[model samples]
Target: MVSKTIQTASPYLEGVYQPVLEEITARDLTVMGEIPRDLNGLFAHNGANPRFPPGAGHSWFDGDGMVHGIELNDGDAIFRSRFIKTQGLAEDLKAGEATYVGSLAMPGQGKRHKNVANTDLVYHSGKFLALWWEGGTPHELTLPDLETRGTFDYQNTLTGGLTSHSKLDPRTGELFFISWAPKPPFLNIGVASEDGRITRFSEVPLPGPRVQHDMALSDRYIGVFDFPLMMDFKRPDQKALGFVLDDETPARIALVDRKDESAAIKWFDIKPCFMWHISSAWDEGYEFVLVGARLDGATRHTKSGAILDDLPLVDGEHRFDSHPYMWRLNTRTGAVTERQLDDSFVEFPRVNDHHICSGARYSYMARIDINQPTLEAQGIYKYDLATGSRTDLKLPMHHIASEMSFAPRDGAKREDDGYLIGFVTDKQRMTSEFWITPADSIEDGPVARIKLPQRVPPKFHGRWVDAEAFRTA
Candidate 1:
């Protein structure tokens, strides 16, 4: 059965998203436009690549992990790609096939699960971590070579799992993430120290299991969005994922102080919505503002062996789509004031890491083609939060882009005075290139278009790692 959303035998295995087998380390790569000499760093991306032929019940979330790195220094480029070599990928290699079920798989297929370790990469505790989207063990991988070392657990203090969209405070070197379960201790929040030790960890009270894809962290507080997208693994619905969207309970947002453990985690009632990612958060003089892309209803994504085209399009399309929105919580009176920021459909909103959790002036996001079934970006957007101005770096027709990462210029004093780096592929020509667009003048398009040896499939998330990171302990 063809996927309605992707319109293929398996959406994960077609077009630009298809996985490649050969891992190569090619140096002195060809460049179309001149690379900036001052822009010296690694543009690293983490993605999924199945080692062997998966079963009919295969899901993209369960694909084996892979990492790709493109290093730039003094106008020279080096390209490297390697599989993450997770224990799950090892098990599949030993069996000569995929042998694990996942949260997106058919119910009762098997109890065995694999932490696919393919969604994101975070440089924390002086090491690169390949994170899985299912909130499980993170595998440590080296940069430039992209070699997987082993799973990390913060000295065994992080027991069950870890979040993929974990936020790192650059000023304090504290990593903030979350953990959720189906049973008691339904949710856990953790803050890790610079030495890779879990310093402050506590359980947030919740009645049932939830899929908190991302959280909001600021200088003063941590914000958790508790949507009504409840989980029921035993549900018999083949059309929907293994869960029930509980419409009875209104969604809630919880806020807790970062330093004060005695401060109770307070839950504020809000209208029901499903938000997969939060762009940025900041502490105003009197209010805490959390901004993100929000869909005004529950979202049921793809499941194993299920055909999405068979589902009702009207009920699924807009329900799964999202828009930029903001919510402000008054510290004095516990009041919530929210409003829509823009009308454009976008996702993966990001700001400069140096301005993270601080008052950032601009946000970079992918402008999606709402007509497409999958989340494919037609262009990139630079939305100004301070002046309500918008700048778009539009790609040509039939060209798609991946998530963009902001890199501050070597001597950049302002927040948006840098470049945006991401991968772009032309579907018609079957060619992929790394584009570097000026952040301040994004409408000018790319200054450098580095040609790649291999097609970079649309991965989940990536980061700009400075050359200084390699010298750290």
Candidate 2:
């Protein structure tokens, strides 16, 4: 599928990060092992796959949003993939070319950039939404067939853009999310009921506009992070990049009551660092503790305000070491205490969906390879938060992996009783495979491996949707 000597202008357009040109649907995929009868759901993921050649100053982040889904039920599996028909991509399809400017393009004041809806994939209220971290209208994709349904606006009351990180509490069936923008009243927090009602949507004023990739939700509180990264708008002499990492400012977290609508939100300052994802958060007595894979500063841009070409690298290598750490804020004294949980550098931290609200003792994250150039993972790390020990499920070299999607077993009692599913691309072969392993046993490898019909490029986050969640679709 690829040659060792293949040459491309951009490293992103080569190997597993390269775009695929097919939309496919295949039934009865061949599996290496027996499919679990108790497993019934879809492991759906979204990615940025450019339909045509990217525009000038094209960062790896710029592309058409594509969703790949594999549905399992009654010991059978089906696979499907589709390009999310976002308004921008639809126009490009009609014109038979790439029309929009790249992500690093300079736009004048009050101008807007294109929304690819390419960063994350989520399921809520029987609908699968393709989301972009840049804060834009979410595009909806249907199940079973993987078809585009158009943009979803939270029953039409959603006024501003929605980010990719919307935390859903499985216990109460309510989704807690925040949206950030570059304009005044920069941040807005929203809570939606199980049936998709926007119950409480209010503006949370900030000192200025910032970039927040993800948020955390606990049983009693919602955590909205404020890092040193901020949007640098266009100027006459300078080209406008999306964001810049400012070391002069401090990082803070705004904690809001999970259920109380009238409670005041408080901001607690922490060390100046940035985290693209949060692991798990909970309330431990008088402390509100949150764990994440932390970096010294934002790695997406350099000190000179130029956007980095590689989304998962710094200076074509592992520029920063990210470790899983926990931060505890004293609710009464307003003091912050933090510590490193492990020594390994990893990211894309996730817990069981049920644990996202109540917190869990275990967390599954992607192990970032120190010598890698792309966002490829060398393995998956299962961290025991209770004992501060780590177990690894390492992958073969040249296998670029995605985030582990935890699929709970039917009527399961334990948290890690289900399967950990993910898609990995063989960078050397340019082909893809779907892997499923027991969540409880980290060292044991995949129980089942299915070769995908299409090559899948390395991309961002995804979640496991239960079989019952797609009854309406």
Candidate 3:
């Protein structure tokens, strides 16, 4: 019997989201500027790179995960790319086609696949873990070569799964994360020690199943969102994991103690809004300050009212307006106050690695162009949290970039004393460039630009693993 071929109307199937058929390893790449000698580490970017075309009703989130990395040592850079080699990808490869439907597929219409491990990459406990945002077992990968080691289950100690945006406290070497599924005790919060041991796990009950994408962590507290956006299994018109902007559901925030399980988990009510990423969070006096991108409503369809899976391309109608905002939660009075931080359109926020669970002076994020056809960013924006000022690191016309990864210099003193690195794809040339810019002078352009051999698809989250991460492994 002849096998059927899949086709897709989704815009992600083409352009930067287009999948690369083969992997390549290149050494001593062409660099346009002086690579900082002190910048010694590996920058690994993880994204979706489907092996096969996802036919109708496919979502961009369904593609297989791929890691594109470059290692820098003493001003020298080497490039290597590889598929995450997840169980789902392996099964599909063995079948000679895609056996499982995408995240937006109708329930019971396709086989359920293992974790795609495509959304983000984190380095903790001396291992690089590739994670999926929708909850799954994180896949471990070795550095320098980007080899897939295997799945990590906390020595089979975890009662729940993992989130893509797990937080690692730089000072304590402890990892904090949360997990959620469509079942009772819908959320599970946990922490892992420096050596990858599950030390604390707690089942946080919620009213119902909600789409909780990211979390915020301060020195002493972990913040999880119970936003208004949730899954509606009764929506027949929208079959795939039915997502609806629930106005009736009140948005709330949950704060749990990072180290003490006996401490009460406090829940505070907030205005209805949606946020998919958190820039940073910290404690101040008696309040917790959380910074992130907030949208008035979920952006899931186009102006034509067509779902993302049915859209041919991402146009302005498909673009959702988002802005940086700061939320302050009072621990004593259960009072919540929020204010818009900036007016610019931005997302994929990042701060220095050393400031993950602490307060930072500045944040670097991708700036989106309103006229662009796709969500690909047009430049980088540096926001000063102290003065509410902004600096723009604009890219050349027709050029797009990825989320900035902040790499601090050796013996760096100040928080902003670091370099920002990320991939920039030039549509005019159909090529990609790896850029490095001083965290304080992003507007001055890259201090170094290493040319990539192939175009990397626009991806989700990545990390900058210092040399010490591998040394201790």
Candidate 4:
């Protein structure tokens, strides 16, 4: 959608003042919702059957899944993992069986329509909570429906916003989630108390109505960044010219002063441009923030015009590595230093609030050894806080992963590194599996690969919920 304001040449300015100000006008831009239409013919069978396609081909909705948080409490495996079953349904439909709801396809490919919907189970204040980003209002599961113990709705209030990512404070046990408003286009940071009442709400600023894909927490402040949102409603041949190059852009980061809650606060910006998915950690008493930036500014919508030229593969030879950089943001001085990674870097960087696990989209085939025979360039680039050194391990290129969780080893303190758990996908099959790799040992293939019963689509973000805390027995 075009923004509400536009600027052009004006006769009121002379030489120096001419470039200083451009004539500005307000235009109402219409934005639409990307709602999924229900298809009558598709089957929703829960059981795995030859007739039913694997989770890959619309079995479970093709979208990201919230993680089954870390199992901290003692209990059986079922309650511990917090794996919510993907509800399945199946039916045969004739010509009129499926209804075309509308199109989510950008104006590009004749505007093809989207077919599925997504709803997820999130854990907050010690129980499983539900939220859906679709058209309907956000809903919550009742107390009787909760499989775990603990009080929710602390302030007897229900807070609603776009809940894509969240984190639980280890010390306070408070929940902080990233939310966004669709109608008015405002970002939000909401805090839910240990008892489940939302005590605070902070409005975060971003350029547009965007998805808060990733966030990192520090001892003093919460750092947030905005992800770019664009669609190709126009033909593929005309997509290159469809972007906003204006100078007035909105700021993405809002530094909330946890120390002074008395209305006076300060915010810091490392001046990241058109970036998405940031990871940060507190290492050796210093807070560091790292962000991934794509320079082209072109989005997946660019692929909508794929049929016109070449179909844009996810791993297409596009400008993936142009603006990717890793910066160290000083929490004390609010100063930032930088290092540039190879251009092809696009995967999410995993951090443990101390160390940054930088992954690169390149690999060496001969030197590194792993269980899989296939070559993997998507190696985990390890960074040490104390020494400031880096290492690379070839985990095999096909292992696409995100939402990495670091757990302490040998029942040590929560701050220590133990094991790393992440959801990985085998791109060939579009299948997802749980991987267990040591946080310190990058040399090993995930110690265990717990394969899912069916193909699971790639997901965005998740938290580690302690299983022991949710056991009914």
Q: For residues 208-323, what per-residue lDDT tens digits would candidate 3 score against the true structure?
A: 77777899899989999887666545545654554666655678899998767888999998777788888999999889999998876664532233454422233212224568
Off by over 4 Å in 1: 1-8, 232-240, 300-319, 471-473
**Model 3 CA RMSD to the hidden true structure, in angstroms:** 3.0
How does candidate 1 score on lDDT? 0.77
Residue pairs with clashing backbones, model 1: 4-309
The digit string of per-residue lDDT tens for model 2 on 1-473 reads 11112124767777677788888988878788888889998888887888887665466777788888889888888888888888888787897777776655555322136799988877776678888888787788877666888898888867777788788877777777788877877888887777866778788778887777899877888889778677555433664455567767788998888777788887899997888888889889878889999987565554455554444563232234688999998878999999888888888888888888686888999998766766666789999888887888878777778788788988988989998888977878888888888998969888888888898887788878888878544
Q: What is the C-alpha local distance difference test score of each model?
A: 0.77, 0.78, 0.81, 0.39
TM-score per candidate: 0.92, 0.92, 0.94, 0.58
RMSD of each: 4.0, 4.3, 3.0, 16.1
Q: How well does candidate 3 score on lDDT at residue 177? A: 87
Candidate 2 TM-score over all chains jointly: 0.92
Ranking by TM-score: 3, 1, 2, 4
Winning model by TM-score: 3
* Evaluation by TM-score, superior candidate among 1 and 4: 1
Lowest summed lDDT window (length 10), candidate 4: 39-48
Model 3 residue pairs with clashes:
7-55
Q: Candidate 3 overall Cα lDDT vs. reference?
A: 0.81
The candidate with the higher TM-score, 3 or 4, is 3
Error of 1 at 175 (Å): 0.3
Instruction: Name every residue pair that clashes in candidate 2.
Output: none
> At residue 31, what lDDT does model 3 achieve?
94
